[model samples]
Target: MQSNIKPVAYYLPQYHPIPENDYWWGKGFTEWTNVTKAKPLFKGHYQPRYPADLGYYDLRVPEVREEQATMAKENGVYGFCYYHYWFGDGKQLLEKPFNEVVESGKPDFPFMLCWANQTWKGVWFGDFQNQVLAKQEYPGIDDYTNHFSSLLPAFKDNRYIKIDGKPVFQVYQPLDLPDSKVFARVFNDLAKDNGFPGIYLLACNVPIYWEPEPNGFHGVISYLFHSFRFREKNTVFKEGSFLGKVEWKWNNFLEGKAIERRKKPKVYKYEKVVTKISKWPKMNFDYYPMVVPDWDNSPRAGNSSMILHGSTPDKWKIHFHNAVNYINNTSPADKFIFIKSWNEWAEGNYLEPDQRWGTAYLKAMKSCL
Candidate 1:
């Protein structure tokens, strides 16, 4: 493994049943519900991705969490950035796994948190219009204070991931925050007041055009893969007939409407997408690159999924190596490559062993490291 570069994979803590999940999706609802029911939308489309080595395990089991940590450690992953969701007014979902990790202190793994500060919507299940499960609200200073206070335990934990003596906390949607600058100032001050060195606040690169500014964040983690939409209009019949033009226009109109209906998932060439990202212009600030092994969210979003086809272990290795090389040459002193995920089976983007490509993606990551 590379000594300088820190490889932190995003960990989704939705394997266990939660009250909200039970209410929103029936009893015993978890990510596996969507993952297991997914079907291929087109030819050669990968679907119903199933776990292999780990099997269909529940996160409530202590041994399951331990095994995950062990596998991550063995595959050259430095740590996990657990997706931390804090709906306004202190309401949180999927807190069982990380909570257990914090309280038990078992596995002795390095970790951090990325606040997935977004409102819960039913867009995934084709209810884009009427379902608002949990709305995100930033009720100003008091809420921010409480939020920081709540995270104090994890920030002070010995196993927390840190950079330059400061515990790392990432914001999934920094721009969504009412006032990001205030958040950074308040959180940083809280860190110092709590007797810690400081906080390394990272802003996720969501908007794609976002630049590193005085937004209270120390750096930006380039999560660009999710933003790329590579599907082009099918124009093969554009010049042949008037009927073709009308049909094309109707199809385009339908697709535009589908944005709201959450229909028609966009598919793209994985190799082309990776190559395009590798050639993207360099950022001016402390920027960390990211990589996705393979992405097919048909499980979660159904036809509304964004699928990246033809993503083999070989292709992943190329993408991973390019990210490593980019960070090494551009910002050698600040080495961080955030993989999109460790195990997000619903999205089909994970390093965990799966039935089709058992440990192949993990091996590719290790090769790059």
Candidate 2:
């Protein structure tokens, strides 16, 4: 069952307290805050998912980071694709863990960066209206040069993950850029100028229908949830009492006026979603399949959350096997698979040990690999 497929799990570095987070969410605010406050929206819905082995570890602790690296490596993950945030003019958020990794060179894990190039809003806290925390700005070539220069140190680090002698970088929302093709070209040239092989830019297949153009990117990585072409037709909301229904209708009319809408969460069948993703048609370019163990963002979005119900480790294993088979049969040369996350607990998507499943998800990943 040996396979050449390289698995890279997307890592979120929001577990530690940062000034921006403190300002936006309050003092001592971190992702744990959201995770702790999460409540189950319906029957059988997993909520307040507690950390088992890791035990709600803080990212500021070096030992915690080392433990994460060890766990990931042991579970057959090839590397971590950390979510790197850089607002124009070189402003960055949640960079302490990765910066330490670069400076200390501990853990010795292979890693890459995916620019989460999107504006920060209050949507996570159920404030979907007019609470712009940080706006994503592309200040043209000068800012781009500064951005590349800042990453040069990490890019040159020996631990950086590369493909075919080129350093790999992913853009979470490539289409959001002023001109994605131009951005890729500049970054590729910058990598070359810094005395390395050209960059292997990967565009995330978010916005579902976004077709990759003749951009400078080498390939596309199918971000599982985002690539899901789920329609409103397939979604169903649980019905409520007559008054509740009238209130819901009224709330829908007053959607923008409220801090949070009191509406039933949209739910989809996980098994059917998995089937659709596993059977996705092959594309012309390098399309790296992504496997999501489970997803339930009710913690972040509350009642407005979109959830995929009924995701067991067994079902996840089936999805993983399908993705692996897809790669082996269609794109053997690329041999890459992206897991939606390593630890996005607030979204109920993680591979880390949890109270209910313990290390079952990791076991499934290791077994599938």
Candidate 3:
């Protein structure tokens, strides 16, 4: 399992302040603002989690990124999948840290980019979804060409992670992409012209059961450890489904409540969800699987976010152990175990050491690998 598996962590660049974030969420608000402001919504809930090893450090400091790279590299983490935002026409957000990394060549860590092409909304700051923050758009070939040209430097860097001599570029919402096949072709042509094999287009978490072979993507990263599980259109909540649904019903009976609060919080136990989420259920197409250390986004979403209650290093270790075996015996060649995050403090989902769990999660991961 260790021989075949490569762990790539999802890295968030929101630790530093951007003009948009500063303007929208106050003068100096960063992801840590949300982290330090969270309150416990239920009994035995952990909130306001603080950093231990890394401290409340800012990403602008190069030493902070070096420390992160050292921690992840030593713990068998393969690369950083930094979320790259392009809100059409070359407009990007939260690119400072990564730009500095590429230019300075300090940590020398392997990295790739995932185009987080979703529209930002006020819902990110506990406001209604009607509030538009930034809209994602694709204005055809010229915009796509410009987008590819901007990242040519990073793509050409020695630290870029690749597959079959192709630099890996992820599409966050392949379904949302207009003329995705054409988009892939353009990137492929651009990569080839720049003296490379091609672009490895990896679609992350596409809806409508996206198939890679048909959709011009080299592969798909399965977010098997989703924070909130939803269904297709016209799908109804049936009895005896996810454990959370049953528990909610039972709790309603005991409390004489209807379990119908608008935007009511949905919580699922990490242990129960583990058993259900571990296996891939066998499919014709192969995929790289994801492992979440823990998740509780109430910090970011208040009472409306999904919480994975009772998450522990032991449980994550167990699930990861199963995932390794599952991938080796079944899935594709690379056998990538894409951890949902390297550091996303606001969502309470990260592998970085916090005040509680101090390097225990890292230890668990190393033990498995």
lDDT on C-alpha atoms for all candidate structures = 0.81, 0.80, 0.81
TM-scores of all candidate predictions against the true structure: 0.90, 0.89, 0.90
What is the model-wide C-alpha lDDT for candidate 2? 0.80
Which residue runs of candidate 2 sit more than 4 Å off their true CA positions? Answer: 1-3, 206-213, 229-262
Per-residue CA lDDT of candidate 2, range 1-369, in tens?
Answer: 364778889999999998888887789988888889989888888887899999988998999999999998888988899999998988898999999989998779999999999778787565566477888999998888889998888889999987776888889878678887788778888989988778888888443344565767777786445535332232234324455444444543343334245377877888888787765557777788888888888888888777889888999999998888888888633687888889998888899999999999889978987
Which residue pairs does candidate 1 place in steric collision? 265-303
Better of 1 and 3 by lDDT: 1
Top-lDDT structure, candidate number: 1
RMSD of each: 6.3, 6.5, 5.8
lDDT of 3 at 1: 30
Against the true structure, candidate 2 reaches a TM-score of: 0.89
Off by over 4 Å in 3: 1-3, 226-228, 232-234, 237-263
Report the lDDT of model 2 for residue 62. Answer: 94
Window of ten residues with lowest summed lDDT in model 3: 252-261
Candidate 3, residue 343: lDDT:
94
